[model samples]
Target: MLRYEMQGGIWVYPGKGGWHFITLPTDVAARIKAAMAGLARPWGSLGVTAVIGKTKWTTSLFPDKTTGSLLLPVKASVRQSERLKAGDAPIVTIEIAL
Candidate 1:
């Protein structure tokens, strides 16, 4: 397993019913790709366990081709529970099982 801890701002996808996400740091993204790219699911997503504040959930890290990074989706429930919103910088922990 591999674990990463990072701080990033939440942003909403620019579209109707915009989805929220936090983009992993470039350094972290590079490391994750080097270690787990082969294990990624379809569309270059990897299963991961994510934690923020006191909330934890099973989710996936999705590839962001333009940025060459991974984006972690922050679901509505988790966001509300964590008191997070767009533009808020939050520390996030992600664990990937090999």
Candidate 2:
């Protein structure tokens, strides 16, 4: 298993859905990709454990074409519990099995 701890600003995807996401830094994303080189799941997504503030949950990291990085969706419950909103920079910890 590999763990990555990073800080990023939350952003809402535009359009009808408007889901909130935290983008991993390019370097961190690259490192994760390398770590999971032979074990990536479908659509380049990886199952992970995400931690934000006092909230933690299981989610998947999806690859973003535009940024060439991975994005972790922020659930509403986590947002509420962590007092986070779109555009707020929060520290996140993610764990994944290699």
Candidate 3:
């Protein structure tokens, strides 16, 4: 099962990108259930760039210890948004193990 966090006026989503709630009207809970499935896809996870976005302007994941892989740069527009700087505040917490 997926969780839909009711944020702002509309339903915001989890991860670093995309709208949170496709549309979970109160009347029919079934629709919300369907939307949750879509939101929970493997593609729904925060991309590699997003992971790096979580810890920028601070330090690297391996400071003074370089790795072969390189993280993508956060787009200027995204850097200006809440999710990139709000830690996990803007993300709807999902309970995947449950």
Candidate 4:
């Protein structure tokens, strides 16, 4: 398992499919990529456990081709529970099981 803490701002994609996501820092993304090399699941995603504030959930990080990094989707429930909003920088703890 790989564990790390990071701070990222929530961003919303434009248009009708607006979705909130947090982009992992390049360094962290690189580390995760290297650690998960040859072990990536379908669609270049990695299963992860994420904790923000007191709320924790299981999800997957997907590679963002446009940004060349990994993006973690924050569910509506999580955003509401964590009191997070777009442009808010929240500290998150993530664990990836290898």
Better candidate number, 1 or 3, judged by lDDT: 1
Better of 2 and 4 by TM-score: 2
Report residue 54 deviation for candidate 3 (angstroms). 15
Q: Top TM-score: which candidate number?
A: 1
RMSD (Cα, Å) for all candidates, in order, is: 0.9, 1.1, 15.3, 1.1
Write model 3 residue lDDT over 1-98, tens digit each, in one string.
34333221223335577332212123223333334444332423311112222433221111111222111223335445534432323322222212
Q: What is the TM-score of each candidate against the true structure?
A: 0.95, 0.93, 0.20, 0.93
Model 1 Cα shift for residue 36 (angstroms)? 0.8
Error of 2 at 76 (Å): 0.6
Total clashing pairs for each candidate:
0, 0, 2, 0
Candidate 4 has an lDDT of 0.91
lDDT of 1 at 57: 99
In candidate 4, list every pair of residues with a backbone clash: none
lDDT winner, 2 or 3: 2
All candidates in order of lDDT, best leading: 1, 4, 2, 3
Residue-wise C-alpha lDDT for candidate 1, range 1-98, written one tens digit per residue: 78899999999999888899999998999998888857889998988999999999999989998898999999999999999999999999998888
| Positional deviation of residue 19's Cα in model 1 after best superposition, in angstroms | 0.3
- Taken over the whole model, the C-alpha lDDT of each candidate is 0.92, 0.91, 0.28, 0.91
